[model samples]
Target: MNNHKKEKGDVMVEKGKLVKISYDGYVNEKLFDTTNEELAKKEGIYNPRMIYGPVTIVVGEEMLLPGLDEALLEMEVGEERELVLPPEKAFGKRDPSKVRVVPIKEFQKFNIRPVVGMPVNIDGNVGKVVSINSGRVLVDFNHEFAGKEVKYRLKLEEVVEEPEEIVKELVKMYIPSINTDDLKIKMTKKTVTINLPEVCSFMNNIQTIKMAIANEVIKRLGVDKVSFVETFEKKKEDN
Candidate 1:
C-alpha cells in the first residue's frame, strides 16, 4: 500500500522543500495581488507584460511574508488554504513617524502637481500623498499594506521529490520561454543533465541561468551536479 507515488496524506510541506504554489493576496476584500491570470484580468489589474505562473517558494526561506511563509510548513500538496495574517506578521503596524509633510512647491519644482493618493518617490523611498492643504502635502511613507491584515488564498500545486524534477522545475521557472518536456534529460544517481533548447543558444544570460538553475537544484534537492549540454549542428559544407 506504500508503493505508489506518495499518498496525499504522506506528503506534508516541510523546510527546504521545492514546492510550487499559486496565491491570491487581498487586503480589505480587494484583490491586491494574484498569480492567476484570469482573476487578474477580471479585476482590471492585468498587465500583459508580466509573466504569470505558479511561484516556486523555498519553504522557510523567508521569501514570503513571515506568516505566509510559516503557513507553508504546514500545507500539503493540493491543499487550498484561505488564511488571514495579522499586521505584525504581515507588514508590521503603520508608523506615523514615516509620515512627512512636504511643501507643494517641492513637487511643483519637479513638474509634479501633487494630488491626494498620488505615489511619489523621494530619496528612493516611495510614498503616497494623503492630503494637500494650501501649499503643503502630507505623504505617508509606510508600506501601503502596513497596519492591516492580509488574506491569502493559496494552493500548493506539487511538492517536487526527485532531483531531476527539481531541475526541470527550476528550468521551467527561470526560463519560462523554454519547454522543459521537449528538452532531453539524462539523470544519474548524483547528477542531472539537460540539453539546452536550440533557441536558447542566443539567450543573453544562458550561462547565468544555467548556473542559477544548477545552484538551486543543489541547494534545494542536494544534487551533486547539474550539467547543461549545448550541442551544435554541422554545417552543410562540412557534411
Candidate 2:
C-alpha cells in the first residue's frame, strides 16, 4: 500500500494510465473576513460541504480539477495524507467585484425574465437575483463555492499500468466525443496506437490532446511516460 519511494524528477504519471483514489475534504464556508469561530459554528448550514469518495482517473486526461491532480502527483500507492489547500490552490478566492447590477432589459436578451430572489442561468453561468429595482437587476456571478480553503484527506488506492485500460479511461475521462466501445487501442513495445471512429472527428489534434490527457491522468492515476498514435480516415477530417 505504501509506495512513497518515488524518485526525484521521475514523472509521477504517464499517458493512458488508470489510478484509483479515495479522498475526503472540507471547504471553509466563510470568506477571509469571517472569523474561524463563526465558521465552525455554522458547519453544515452555511459552511462548505466536506466531500469524500473514490474515483478512477486516467492520467494526462484532465479528469479532475488541476489543483487536485497536482496534490496526487507526490503521493504513492496506498499513500494517505491530509492536504490543506489554500484558496489559490483550491477553488480560488471569491471576488466581490464580480457581483454587479445590470439593466433588467439585458435579461430579456437571453429570453429570461428577471424575478426577485430567483436563481437564473445566464449564458451557462448561474446566479441568484439579489434585487429588482427601477429597471435594474443585481446578480452575483462568483462561484457559490469560491474563496474557501479546502482540506483533503486522500489515499491512492490502485494504479493500472496496462495500455488498453488506460486508453479506455482516456476516452471516458476526456474524449467523450467517441463511444468507449468504438475507440480502439493497440500497444507495442515502442508505441500505443489509438483508433477512433469517423464520428469522433473532432479529436483531430489527437497527439496534443493525448498529451494533455496524459498529464491529467498521471496526476490522478500516478504513473509515468507514454507515447501515443492516433489515426483517423482522411475524408472525415474536420475543417
Which candidate gets the maximum TM-score versus the true structure? 1
- lDDT by residue for model 2 over 1-239, one digit each (tens)? 35456777755654445787765557663333211334434553334442223456755556654566776777666777766787777766888887788888888787878887788777777878888999899998876667866776667777866657765766555664445687666665544556656655555776677777667545544555454444555676688
lDDT of 1: 0.83
TM-score of structure candidate 2: 0.55
In model 2, where do residues sit more than 4 Å from their true spots?
1-18, 28-67, 116-126, 175-185, 188-239
Each prediction's TM-score versus the true structure? 0.73, 0.55
Model 1 worst lDDT run, 10 consecutive residues: 1-10
Instruction: Put down candidate 1 lDDT per residue, 89-140, tens digits, no spaces.
Output: 8988999999999988889888999889999998898999999998989999
